[model samples]
Target chain A: MHSISPADFAAILLSLKVGVTATILSLPFGFAAAYLLTFKEFRGRVVLDGVVNLPLVLPPVVVGYLLLLLLGQNGWLGALLNAVGVRIVFTWRAAVLASAVVGFPLLVRSIRIGMEGIDDKLIQASRTLGAHWYDTLVTIILPLSFKGIVAGSSLMFARSLGEFGATIIVAGNIPGVTRTIPLAIYDYAGAPGEEAMALFLCLVSVVISLAVLVLHESLAMRLARRREP
Target chain B: MKLAVEVVKSFGVFRLAAAFSSAGDRLGIFGESGSGKSTLVNLLAGTMPPDEGAIFLDDECLFSREKGINVPPEKRRIAIVFQHPHLFPHLSVRGNLLYGYKRCAPENRRIDLESVAGILKLEGLLERGVNNLSGGEKQRVAIGRAILSNPRLLLMDEPLSALDDELKFQIIPYLKGVCEEFGIPFIFISHSMTEMRLMAERVIVFEKGRIVQQATADQLARLRMPTSQVGYINLLKLGPPRQVDGLYAYSWGGGELLLSFPVRRPDSLIELSSKDIILFKRHPEAISSRNLLRCRVVATFEAGNRTGVEMDCGGERLIAEVARQAAVELEICAGGELFAAIKASAFRELG
Candidate 1:
């Protein structure tokens, strides 16, 4: 029955944008990493897996600091990109990048499990049937693991929507620009007479997380049915 | 078309050294468990590289150690179906059938979806999701998928080994028709002699990572080898001339015989009932049957419901199966001379 303030609405839209952008940007890399980890046997596989999982174990601020070091103007990659007139720090895009980095571990882990659950014989059969490696991956492996991909993406989106620490450190919570729902909630909770708005945002976050969980469960059930003889 | 493969591989303690060549013919690999039959299939499929060897398809070198040429599976155009049907779980039966079909060379596509479906009896299953298929249905779809790819060779690694006998029987006629229609060289791996008899034109017996023998189906059936810690039975093959002077000599064993009715061409392989043969302590006269051999029992062993009596008759070794009760009633024992009376028609030739 209560109307949302302009600021609160902008924060919700910003959160959606950041979450969707983060999920889309991270998907290809997540799939590649997961596929490599699941199918390839290499000398540095353990190291690669550990590195991809680092964001999960490290403090959010530490991930943000690492991102800053890599994307900062004077940093190696940052300088190269700056010379091309590209900027990532302290921007909405930077928020998306931060969210992606923090959410990548979950996506890659889920996708890896999905890819590993596939029958290797299926892939071999495809190959013998004249499909090249890439064709087999695209047509056989990816489609067969669709539920896993959906589940991973949904979890990543939900996680990115709630991202606070890494986003604050990297994009700096600028109002009407980089500030997301979680950041807005933090700001409103700090100000007097903003309790109602903060509660509303919190409730929205809960709803989104619940929706994702339900979607994941349904997808898993469908997959289970598909696997039944 | 011909396939020549010679490969040697070692996996920790398991070693595999397989070598064989076939000229557009079906070759069956026979062995017990752990004999590396599947390993040979994998190597030929190009799924795994052999430590040393060469593989040639006709004149093309698929894999050659001396030349360092190893064509990947995709380029080899050889399709393999594993013991477990590996249909794509996410695809419908039709989609699975087309998955490989689309990737093959357009000009090389010799088999169409309709023909493949007809061959495997997959037309009714085209719209169904692969996940809901029964084991036999899955295998049929898998075979259909492979055939649609227009592969030069088809590798079946115990494709029926996972199914029950009834299901196997149900699908065998379809498989036979496919082979006859296409004349595609097949390398079928199986431990079941019955399956080998049905599917393979030639048999290659494997023992301990090596091919012990390679012969035609008839020769393999007649081969007498030491059975593995178990009893060995030599199969007697009976050709045409079902009636020779009103006496059809079906099988001569242990100087004994049983009468069998004449069967038309291509009868199902029958397991001759050992109990059917009647053993007489003395040669019986006035019998209409013509086959009667005198022999002495060399060994007598009781097996489950029947006693296995090994007898030697005029340079021929025979095994007669007699019920325990009959053995007791007749007092049949080792070193006892007995007249084995078998009707000319009782011999069932097994290939």
Candidate 2:
């Protein structure tokens, strides 16, 4: 029988918390960006869309470096926060921010595709039915794009769980405080005679990724059925 | 409830320019596809902004380029039902219906959920998911949802065009009842003359993006068909006449007209064409005709003097065609009574 260490178990729980927080923080902004990109036409729209997707093409380390410059204690935004006595650097919240930055592109892209696939006439009909923009979004757009939201959140959570480069650079690996599962696995793998613990963490990551994938596929299938005329 | 609109907009290569108005009435916008009917509805509903012009619903100006006023769709107080019902897939029938009502201001609320459901015959569907509804059922739910919003105006852009004839017929009465009960002004778009006759009291003909004609229902119907086709046929007031049997009899001009041909279904209204009619000046002495009526022409018209005359015999009217020379010789004119004859086979059943 394999025994799991308390520190390793704490890392798992912390990883879940980070993944969930990142997903929740990014979802509303992701939906808004996706909807604007898919439905509205304005000057510089293409530029805005490209910017939202920058995190996907740029290296995770680069994203973390950018975050550090903007959010570190002596950084521009960090200076303003320090004046107000609020700190975000080298904390669990910083890990969530890094995860969200890396996962945003994926979340927005999926939701945009889902928004584009919806029938425009349906939105028009809702407008004619006396619903305003916010009402229409809540009642029509959100409900219809629910599958995309679920899929995007799942993908983001899975990606955040495995986040290593950005999290390491921004939050700095600290056991029991900031060290998530992926970071702990990296730390264990670096030490001599800790190969078994590293392997166990890797196996756990694979299982989580697989489960999320299965759940996403099932949700997507159900949404497809509902869309059928 | 007057609705006046003038809008000009361009989308890529498609340019739309339209202007028209209607009082408190059921006005139909009739045109072929790509004639900008849907675009007109969109403009009216405030979904698309017009490059120029204004729309006034009664005294409230919904949109105006001159005044630089553009009300958003939610504040327009208008309801629209598209050809596709567009019910929210995640919502049940009840949820879909209640969505608009919840969004409306309390002071502006006029329709209740129960009343809308009852009017649209949607009581049995409240608990069902919108995704599970049939084509007709979805339309009913869509209508109910729109009504519950307490809209001042209702726009229907070919709402029944997607359904089959049977379904269209099934749901049309409910729609008509909704309009009548609420006294809400309706701008209904349709291509079918039959549907126009069934619902609209006024008609606005569209050619391209321009309004060609706007007339009352009876005037539109008269202008649509030739003068020869405008007349009353012998209407049989049936009281549970034979079930499934097509044969029936009705009296007109003190004569019996036997309907020997099986009507297939007699529960619905039927229309007949004027071209199928054959007229005679005298009662046929010898013929296999199953239907014949003796009557006098109350009115007549000269169809280039070639077609003899259109005769109104008692309450039934029939058209007879004769040579131009024969019309001068017979001396047929208005108020001249004449014998009109028809063969039973000429009456084709239109359901």
Candidate 3:
């Protein structure tokens, strides 16, 4: 194993930061999307479902390109942000955005499955009991889908840690600002006589992924135990 | 609750067109599966929208396609005890019971959680999670939850269909007692004639998505006797039993009934199938049946291949089914005397 450098350590910390930020920001939106897709009937439902899942099937590089087009300087969203004296492109925020967009589908899909498994009669009972739809969602649907939320969050966080193609395109790989562990590993693998450093970063990625999976499994087991007799 | 409903709903080839006015507190919607009983419940509870129709409860318009007045389910204040318990799995027994009570409007709330829990006998199980509850206990919690909502009308959609015979009988009392104690009118939905008779005073019979008949629950039972596999069930309420010879003797309708099954309750209900009674024009010297009641023929009605002999035994009314040929042999007529023989083992104890 090679000794860790300042840049490598920054990469590890930035990866954790981006993963946490992205997961936290996407939680509410992902929950809403899942609820809408699973429970409600509305026009353009199928289209919304397709749009939410497009990122999952599309290549990360392609998604990165689309995010670049949507948030780049001359883009409508970018122009609106510029009016407010804010810049998203080529910053750590852009990297978080890139990771969020790439991992959103997985989160929504998991939560949607959880919501769909709920018995229809239970929802009907809640409504007839004088609970409005939102009240039922908060009390019944949210608590029932806790396992799915935990699982999805872990998946999205893990995905964000490995996010590289989209971050490099939209956030432009800046060593202390936007470079994550995967990006740092890519830089080391491309240099001469830096195989050991790349291997060390690869070991770090494995350890983080394993830790996330173990945490997810423990959470899911606890939930299962609590739900059973 | 006086409910007037004129609703139409369709799903592909099946269309439900039902209209009726029920003023009774205990109204039974009796129908077999796919006969639109559940659909009507959904429409009345505001869970499903009617294509075009109107619904009024106690002269208050709940839905009117012409007037564009459609109240959502939460605002309608009609709660249902579904076939399955359907208790919120994520909640404890207490939480599930209070889920609706907390949301109920203050002025509308009449029943409190403590009272409901007492009525349903759910106090001990309140803090426990719903997952471990027995089927009967879970159903009690479901009933408690619905009752605590303080709705004007309770819709029981085949609530007992999911339980075994013992559990079904156990839950029926809580269902009836809670509604009666709280003064909440209910519409009981079921295909079981016995259940309908026990729960509802008046019944609306549905067949193939239409209202075929509206009559008292007993009338409906007698009307369908020939077609029903179990025939007409004669529900009898008897006083506490005394041991006589090897059987339990119960003082019944102006007479005594010897039952092979012993019951310990002060007052017990027993059911005897109409086919179980054998009528004889003359008292036979050699008869194996234990009880012989001399009854006068009140009226005779023809039901398919059998003649239903409506007899007045002392002051109680008992209907006995006999073959049409046997009826002619006995020369059965109104206001005529006849001997009805029944075995001690024929009486089945009920909850």
User: What's the lDDT for all of these models?
Assistant: 0.80, 0.78, 0.91
lDDT score at residue B44, model 3, on the 0-100 scale? 93
By lDDT, the better pick of 2 and 3 is 3
Give the per-residue lDDT of model 1 (tens digit) for B1-351. Answer: 687888898899989988888774788899988998988888888999899999989879988888999999999888987888888877789988997789899998888999889878788989888878888898888888877788888888888888886677667776777866876777888987767867888888988888899887644643432232222333343334345545443443323243355544343343443444568877786676556778789987766566777778766666776668888887888888987765555555442
Per-residue error for A218 in candidate 3, Å, reads: 2.5
Tell me the tens digit of each residue's lDDT in model 1 across A72-151: 98879788989999998888988999999999999999898889888889889888988888988998889777777888
Off by over 4 Å in 1: A1-4, A214-229, B224-268, B273-351
Write down the lDDT that model 3 would get.
0.91
All models, RMSD in angstroms: 7.2, 4.1, 1.7
On TM-score, the leading prediction is 3
lDDT of 3 by residue, A1-229 (tens): 4578898999999999999999999999999999999988999999999999998888888888888888888889988998899899889999999999999998998898788888999889999999889988998899888888998999899999988888899998899988899999898899888999999999999999999999999999989888764
A113: Cα error in model 3, Å:
0.8
Local error of candidate 3 at residue A96 (angstroms): 0.7
List the candidate numbers ranked by DockQ, top first. 3, 1, 2
What is the alpha-carbon lDDT for the whole of candidate 1?
0.80
TM-score of chain A of 3: 0.96
The digit string of per-residue lDDT tens for model 2 on B267-310 reads 45445444444555556687666555555555544444244355
- Report interface Cα RMSD per prediction: 2.4, 3.1, 1.3
| Model 3 ranges off by over 4 Å | B264-268
